[model samples]
Target: MSTTKTCVRSPVPTIALCFIVALFEGLDVQSAGIAGPAIAAHFGLSSSMMGAVFSASIIGLLPGALAGGWLADRLGRKRVLIVAVMIFGVFSAATAMVWSFESLLIMRFLTGVGLGAAMPNLIALASEAVEQRSHGQAVSFMYCGLPLGGALAVLISNAGLEGSWKAVFYVGGLGPLLIVPLLCLWLPESSAYRAQKGRDHSAPTRRLRVLFQQAAARPTLLLWVSYFFTLMVLYILQNWLPSLMMSQGLVRSEVGTVQVALNLGGAIGSLLMGLLMDRWRIMALIVSMYLGTVAALAGLGFSSQFYSMVVAAFAAGFFSIGSQLVLYALAPRFYPTSIRGTGVGSALAVGRLGSICGPLVAGQMLATGSGAAMVLMAATPGIVVAAAAMLLLVAGQHRNQR
Candidate 1:
């Protein structure tokens, strides 16, 4: 193995800058959820219509993920990230101003495109900036901004602001706007990416096809499968857990508190897992999956016991959500720098399909009176699936080396 003597240090200022940008990106992504109730009330919308509003953004995300990766590979990560942030911010503000449902949906979809594009580039940038050994920790630390941002949204909403949910959108939109100039000034282009792009000799299509082909081999396939199911469970929890608690007669403030706890646990878990990754990569994955599975089951089976429920939620957040950060950390190491962005972005893009399905499936199941137990139980398959996939990946890696 060839190791570079670059000895890149993740400076506090640069990481802080990246965290703020990532925070804005996360807030923008979750703003719709914060604003959904008010929007529905304003428009006298049906539940189905409200669901469509939520779905539109995710629909835009699919193409955005793929396109953003390709763009970052071509134009550079910093440039694409800044542009996406600006686009999302602009559309988010536009969403706040729009009166018609159709217009709001259109703006939301556009914002999703920006939001989706931002994440992969952020991952690519963070992964490339750090030394290989510290890759997992750096990426996990960077992604901690996500759950923190979501928690911030809940806090802002709870403060009983005067302008209703529209205020959340305005704030969410302005966050990225504020960060854009700072990002341009402080965020450097990925040095590794720049070097690889300079050596590019093939058509972009050929390049992409080749990258996808490389990803089709055993370990890559296993990683993608693991990522897909993990995302499914994570997204389901993110979108439905609050509502699930609310349905069990928990007050809105308590529901928000649960979300905060979940996020806090996730942040802590990511940091811990990052450290563990360097020492026991495969063992860390197994432990995370097993913890997630147990947490899900516990949360579902003991919905009425507030403390137990919270503990279960915390465990789920700690294991499942943080595992995602671990996945992003591991992704760059799995592929060479030449296709790092593509590999990570494609995994994220495909994983997002599972994210979309998760909420929808949970919604249907909840309607059928599946209860918290069923919902929590639903998460088990995802963990088991992910664990099996990881084992396959490990086996594949050993075979490849041999």
Candidate 2:
């Protein structure tokens, strides 16, 4: 697949491609959550073993993200993304036929390679597609596909679909297959990426080094800290909310409904935050973090009733998931184009570590069965307070930079 030489300018097609990519990515992620019980039942695996299976994917994501970012920078965003989509699609289907737990873990880990690689490419592509001023809106809009795709996966699985767990993977696998042809036809190479590639490679490397040094050194350290903590909370909620609700004695149908509500809230949050980001970047972040703090606390402790739980779940999804999507949108603006992929990829790779720990910690807590719920609730205040402090530091640094 040769990269497109001509710069394409249509936002609609570009956004459509991003949405499709995000849809399949979200489908693959949500499939595991939806199918966890079935997989455990079929294999008679303990919760710890199940956690390992899910973590396998995250483990693969670490390398996938780093490699995908480099590939997008070196080759082209469109090419790498198409390859990733196909890889995940094929492996997800293959996972359905795995005869044992170890086999399933290996397959999912391979699929995670594809899944992790696909996301940063989407972010980079979307960021490059639009004007700098509109970058946040563009990225946030594209990421809406994440929550929507997740919601679709849950809804489809909940609809019975022959009551087979494998159906979830089938749907997830088919999504990328459907998107690949369109991607080949419509997706365009990023102009910014090409411009960067055309530059003196050594110059770009130097610039990247400076950017990282700046980011890691003083002022930007706060941004990285906030980014890490925010993702820790967000990923934990996304990966475990359904299971947590089930632990609360909700039926599977109710779990699906709550998941849908949460995702729906995320969709709304992404759009709202994107708009807000354009006008008030720092203020918007602060407000979203505060909302996330409240929602998380509410979701963990209160909300015993079905409707109340749904509301709390929706708020949690909106604030936590929504805020992180906003952060991705805003990330590119903080760094120069020379090292944009590296910066974003590094942040995401670090966040993936947090994501990896989240499920494991939750599983261990569940196993202990003492103060488990409270401990989970405690993640909210701890993360939010840290995030708030970091953001304040970032704002102070920005003021000083000015």
Candidate 3:
């Protein structure tokens, strides 16, 4: 592998830039949750209304990822990415100024569009920048920024913000706006994208159509399925874990500690998973991760003691978030650079659908008097389904290889 890890000429800098962008993504995600309560109190809104506001941004992500990925292929990754940053930054700051629930929903949805657009472009740029052997390292390491960003938002909120939820949005907004100039100066466009653009003056829609061709169809469908279930379980934990834990008689303060443990484990998991992927067989690694995740979820649901729950949370993060990074690392390899943006974006858009459903299902289950443990256990069957999809994907890849 070429160790041409240089600035302006190398991917290291681009990966670093993507990591910063991922931090903004993570920061925005946590900020909404942290601010949701204060925003509700301020507006005298019910929990359902606030939940709608939260879902608005997520709803925007589906189209954002779709349109952003499509545009990145047609226009350019760097261009789309910068515009995405600006969209989120400006609208997210505007979120602080909303006078009512409707306004808040609009701003958040707009901000989500920007975030959605940024994701596949960032992944495309980073994935294309590096050697194939190092793709996992680049993507997974870049994602470490996500959990870190979440952690940063929490710290800033707890220490810096003076009971004003808008302060979180201010920090979230300012970071990306400030990064835009630096991205323009330092972030290089994907060489693969540039090459494809040079050879084909084809319209973007034409290129997108290639993904549905016979050779691509099976893998595309399976990838979308895998992404869906993968995100379903993840968002379930992210959205409902705290509430579920508190309902289980855990003290409020301890719930915060649980989040810390989970995110900290997530960071470590991303790092380790990246290293392992570069060295191990991906199939073996993925199977290990899936089984480990099932174990962790089972443990989390079954354990009643304080220490066991915390340990389970840590293990859950280690396996689930870690596996997500692995899947992301693997995603780009499924498509040539020509439609990589579209492929990744489409899969993520599907994943967002699962994200939307995760919280809703969890809420309904809980409302119906389902135990916290059972609510979590509900994800196990989905994980098994996802694992089967992955195996089918591997089998299909082998056939293609032959």
Candidate 4:
């Protein structure tokens, strides 16, 4: 394995830049959802069509992640990231200018590609920036920008765009473009990548095949299972939580409050859990997070009172979202610099499939007359499976070290 320490002495600047990019990525990711009603009104989209519109970017994310990581491995993280920002930024602005439904779909799909491509690089760069001991904290700190950025999107939406949804797209688009110069001026390439490149200029042969070799097959499969189920739970909540709340007779305002609580809890969880993973017992921390996640899900499913629901939502975000951070932090450690981007990106690409599946499955279950509690209960078995996989991965890593 290439050295975890990089040529760059200070990790602060790298992490800070990655955080800015993630914040914008989060904004763009959530912008479509926030502005969905206005977009539907403008385009006269049917419910099915609007669903397609929402899924357009998500569908684009899978290929984008695969391609972005591949390019980052070959071309360099800094360059690929700039291009990704430009792709998403320009296309996001184009979304505002779109005149037809087809045009809007095209714009959003391209924007999704950009957003998808940027994430792997973000994970790779952030992980490489710090020492191995601080990898979890660094990656977690970078991830905090995601939920915080979502909060920023919410704030912009609430600022009242006068039903002009284009305004949201414009802000999401321009913010990243404005940051391009800063990235070019200040963002450092991963020295880990640089060192690996120095040793072997030849392109990685059969990168996918490499991930399964060298005793990597087990961890890689386990990581995919963890990522898939974890993200499934996350997207299920993100897309369906409001409906679940309303099903219990909560008002729109109360639902909004619960949503805010979820995001705030996610931001805190990402930051705090990352720090904790660095300092606390790894197995204990992982076990606690998964247990908290299961409990939170039950809380969301069973709680009828508003205050109890709020507390449940917060815990859900804290643990469920924190579980994602743990996976991201753990992923980079499984592969060397050569295949790290591919490994992480591939796992994320698979996870995106879960994200897409999550809401659909929840909707189907609801359509079959299942209540929120039932839906939440259905997820418990999957959570247990994900928890077990992670625990095994952590145990394997500890054994290897010993």
**Which of the numbered candidates is closest to the native, going by highest lDDT?**
4
**TM, every model:** 0.91, 0.91, 0.92, 0.90
lDDT of 2: 0.76
Q: Candidate 1's residue-wise lDDT over 1-402, tens digit each?
A: 998787564446556777787777766766676556567678887545655676677777777887887778778888988998998888888888988989988998899888888888888888788788878777877888887787787677677888657776887888899888888887888888877876665555765576557545555677778778888887767766766776677787787777777777777777777777777756556665566656655764566877777777777778876788877787777777776667677777777787777767777776667877777787786778787777777667657768
Taking the tens digit of each residue's C-alpha lDDT, what string does model 3 give over 1-402? 667765446788889999999998878866776565567678997545655666778788889999898888888899999999999889888888889888998998998899888889988888888899899888887988877877676566556346567887888999989999999999888888987895555666776678888788888888888888988898777766766787788874566677667777788899899999899877888899899889999998988988899999989988988988877887888887768888899988998888777767776776678888898889998898888898888888878889
Candidate 2, clashing residue pairs? none
Better of 3 and 4 by TM-score: 3
The stretch of ten residues in a row with the least summed lDDT in candidate 1 is 211-220
Off by over 4 Å in 4: 1-8, 36-51, 97-104, 198-205, 246-252, 367-369
RMSD of each: 3.2, 4.3, 3.1, 3.6
Lowest lDDT block of 10, candidate 2: 199-208
For candidate 2, write residues 45-87 as lDDT tens digits.
8777877877888887878877776666667788999999999
What order do candidates take by lDDT, descending? 4, 3, 2, 1
Model 3 root-mean-square deviation: 3.1
Model 4, range 1-402, lDDT digits (tens) per residue? 776864447999999999999999978887776566567677887545655676778778888988888888888899999999999999988899998989888998899899989999999999999889889889998998887776676677666567557877888899999999999999999989988874434454488788888789989999999988898888777766766787799975676677777777888999999999889998898899999999999998999899999999999989988889999999999998988888888888888887777756776777678899998878888788889999999899888889
Q: List residue ranges in candidate 3 displaced over 4 A.
A: 1-8, 44-47, 201-205
Residue 56, candidate 2: C-alpha displacement in angstroms: 1.4
